[model samples]
Target: MVEFTYVVSSIIFGSLFGMMAIGLTLTYITTKVPNFAYGSFVTVGLYTSYSLYRFEAITPYLSAPIAFGIGGLTSILMYLGILRPLARRGSPLVSLMIATLAIDIAFVGIFGTYANYLRYTYVFIDSLNFTEILGDFSIFGSQGLILAAPLTLALITIGLYLLLTRTKFGVAMRASVENPSLARVLGIDVEKVYVFAWFLAGGLAAMSGSYYTLYSQGGIATGSGLIVEIFAASVLGGLSSLYGAAIGGVIIGAGENLLTGGGISVFGNGVLDYQKGIPLVLMILTLLVFPQGLASLPWIRVVTRIRRISGRLLGGIRRLSARGLRRC
Candidate 1:
């Protein structure tokens, strides 16, 4: 029962990881650049929840939608104020990534300062810890995150699929992602698509962060600290594919909880302290062995082969049936 509980807990964490990574994947697909500042945006969500609770005495769970809106607004502003201008000037991808890194660095100081101010000004409020709020809500001998994380993941995944496949805006966004110049020629506002893409990415990250605080201890430094694992999951999912990123997030999540979190260590004992290194190792191994990521693995190849064979067989059957009808 204990081991099963541990596995269940890992799955919950994995679902949250998938949620965050899917956002990163969306931004990468549209912009062709990995936003290093993404982690900072998540940190913003954490602080937003913290502030709501401290100032209004509202539960952190209620602050989630607000956090998402704040994150989306922040992303749009960053795109309009910084990234857009830089892109218009034909800034290189490397430079844009570095700019995001700079944003992350700047946000670190900003969050830290705000946290300090909250602590000093409101001595009664414990701004750093909100585990108590999470404790208030429980179901089926489990915490809220066990339901919240997976439910959020399912909704976002389905929403994204529908948006990308059914809606006109989604079609335009996909076109812009595939070829911005061609999309512009087709009378699509590629720039607007880029802005929307960033907004979705930021909003997803913030939502994930809000759910994260329910399961884990959170502070100003929390999101920044998890950036590595987030990046690893994104890369593992093939950065280009949202579905792949989601799967990658879950794998990395389970690995962290099961291996390094000391549920059942493959590296003998005392692995708890080394939990931080799991992401780095996974990232390195992924780059070395499967440069294209898990999406391009042997199972994918097998599926492709099966699809091709089935298509060929169906075509052959159609041709024979058509010939038989002609003879009649």
Candidate 2:
């Protein structure tokens, strides 16, 4: 029963964290920035939503859409206004790195300038009471939102997969990702593709941020505080693979909870405090071991091998027939 409770906790944490992991992967894979702005995106959503809740005559649920929109748009604007220009100017990688750092600092300044330093303040949360939605496990209110995160992420995955795999725009964006020069040669608008990718990632990040605030209610101080862990989850799953990042997040979330349970011991310390680091440690270990990620685990490899063999055999048969027809 305790294990069951942990699993629930894992799911809730995993789902929210999974969203962040995906956002990080999207930006990194799509733009190659190795973003730290994502943490700020999380903070902005929390403080922004809390401010709206405090000032405006709106309910938590009602303000959700506004919070989500603000979070998404704000991030997108930053990339467009700041990062994109730097890239266009043929900035070197180190220069771009410094430019991104400047953007992050500018973000902090903007927070104080606009948010009236509320970005630095913390909000106290009441004991979460949600015995109904998740059964008798009795978790926090935010946990419910966290638990629902997976559904949101799943919808996003389906939508994005279709967009990239099934739609023209998606195909163009992927071409931009794989080989931008060739894509441009093929008459695809590379800049537009990049802009759309930024929007997609920004929107996802913003939703993740809003969901995180709803769950933690820790306000700005702890909002998006799990960034390090999110990075770890992405790495553990293989930063290049979206599905790997998602599943990796869930497994890490659950494993952290599991290790904190009965009879668990590490470094002769309590598992609770060290739970956050489990993902980090696993990330490091996984990178060192299966750097390609569990995406290429033994079972996956076996299936791929069979497919390769079948393709080769089929190609041989086709070639033989073509050669015979040409001779005739």
Model 1 residue 71 CA deviation (Å) reads: 0.8
Q: In model 1, what lDDT does residue 118 have?
A: 84
In candidate 2, which residue pairs clash?
142-215
TM-score of each: 0.86, 0.75
Clashes of 1: 0
Candidate 1 structure, TM-score to reference? 0.86
What TM-score should be assigned to candidate 2?
Answer: 0.75
Model 2 residue runs over 4 Å out of place are 1-5, 57-62, 112-143, 221-224, 262-269, 296-299, 302-328
Q: Which predicted model would earn the best lDDT?
A: 1
Clashes of each: 0, 1
